[model samples]
Target: MTPNDTKPSAVTVRGLVKHYGETRALDGVDLEVREGTVMGVLGPNGAGKTTLVRILSTLLTPDAGHATVAGYDVVRQPRQLRRVIGLTGQYASVDEKLPGWENLYLIGRLLDLPRKEARARADELLERFSLTEAARRPARTYSGGMRRRLDLAASMIGRPAVLYLDEPTTGLDPRTRNEVWDEVKAMVGDGVTVLLTTQYMEEAEQLASELTVVDRGKVIANGAVEELKAKVGGRTLRVRPADPLQLRPLAGMLDELGITGLAATTVDTGTGSLLVPVLSDEQLTAAVGAVTARGITISSITTELPSLDEVFLSLTGHRASAPQDARPADSREEVAV
Candidate 1:
């Protein structure tokens, strides 16, 4: 969408809830996405990330609460919301029998674009996604990465103002994943608001201006990358010894500095290493000085911030492992709107 066409607050949700029998899929989840910015939704498996996306995209209704996408109520104005939103799920949804260009063209036509406009859009997306060289090939012949790009292109056919990408880069190589990230950046530059769901910490850090961490169907933490990391704790000092014989002295130094729970191991199989967690920068410097004074040669000393995985584990009681590849094939029962 063009910059002039973009509106602020493309998505807003409050107290959204969905249930499956006795299980609460979404427990009063609240989310907001600003216009022309990427908002990343992060969570571990069974955390209701997909359900929130589905509700906002108009695929599923909520048991309680309200949501609006692109200024239209998702429940009351489902058709209007659907028209302005594009959803690309964890799996590619392209028709294997259709050629790459044809798949995009078909979606354009489905969105009521004229034949000429549809064809032009198809070609434009084909070139934009670097699929022009293989545009005429059936989707079945395309690689996993190619199929994913085509699927993403299909969703953009109508120039959606709000896009929902649910784990869009799963199962792709690093190169292809970077390509997708580039496209997402381009979309934001062009003023399309995005809601991206993923378990990849780096992905969220790279693209999202704001992030929400969900656990057990509730938002446990939400903020910018640095802010979330700060919530987990401060920096950690890491030290690796030059000699295995220095481990004992290192432990004593760490103990003298009041840095307890110092763990030692051979990280490089041959090189001795000791990892200890200190509370502050002053403690880090004191520990290092004490070890060096004891004639211990320090191979490496560095300060490490808590990763997103560490933040998630600290906030939620579980680590953000890679999501499973399984997608429910059967349609789930609809809950109340």
Candidate 2:
């Protein structure tokens, strides 16, 4: 189990609130990122994920609540907090006019490293991210993935204790995304704790052992990746009744079975079917037999493990509808204060 006793939170937040005008960008949010582990904050685009990252990175101050990174308060001890934390924002913040090597070197220098040490660190990271061949090329000449790697490498130049990655793989190709994932795994292995925010469901599942779902500027659900899935149900049993009229009754009957406790069965209005999430073969069998015993015919029946998309829908009462362009009011709360 990640975030187990063996590890304690390197970062902690309590009732962290931030507002952009009248909009509550973050509403009483609380979180924990265990030391040396990845805590994935998963939500739809414009779901206040970026705002949370900004506040944690000490770039923006919160309106209410408190946050600490490496035992330093974000508001009161921002300088110390900044020293122990790194941030890779949604878009690549690298200077396109500079080469990859220069970008990293500049960041290292800003961190107050000696000139030679900064140069060595920059080269080392270029090799680690497989950008050595293109290190001399300007950032604008680099590919999307390469620039992202450079941005990430720059964040790590100071060897910070905690890193905040806000949608780091948002626009990369699958291959490049996987490459970033490998680097993150390597960082965690080296005892660097990370707090990762992403809209991609697979990214959260693949990178973080612990996960939190943020929506409408609040933490809606949180647990281990498997724990959250299990909460929504690992396997969902889909049953389409031959008679639409039988849908509700069949759902009630299955719910009465208490195989998964109250509210376990949901009626899928679109297809007039009952979706009963089951944990075992026996529970699936019981629900099916109960429907048939009641003279209700099942038009189609199947069982499938719940996808993260489904989990998001179930928790938020809506599909994880992400916008491609500038976000609506809720998610684009990263206003400078």
lDDT of each: 0.81, 0.83
Residue 208 deviation, candidate 2, in Å?
Answer: 0.8
Indicate the residue-level lDDT of 222 in model 2. 94
Over 4 Å off, model 2? 1-3, 237-282, 285-304, 321-337
Q: TM-score per candidate, in order?
A: 0.83, 0.79
Q: Which stretches of candidate 1 lie over 4 Å from their true place?
A: 1-7, 239-252, 259-275, 281-302, 323-337
Q: Tens digits of per-residue lDDT for model 1 on 18-93? A: 9988889899999878898899998877889988988888788899999888889988999877778898987789
What's the residue-level lDDT of 238 in candidate 2? Answer: 84
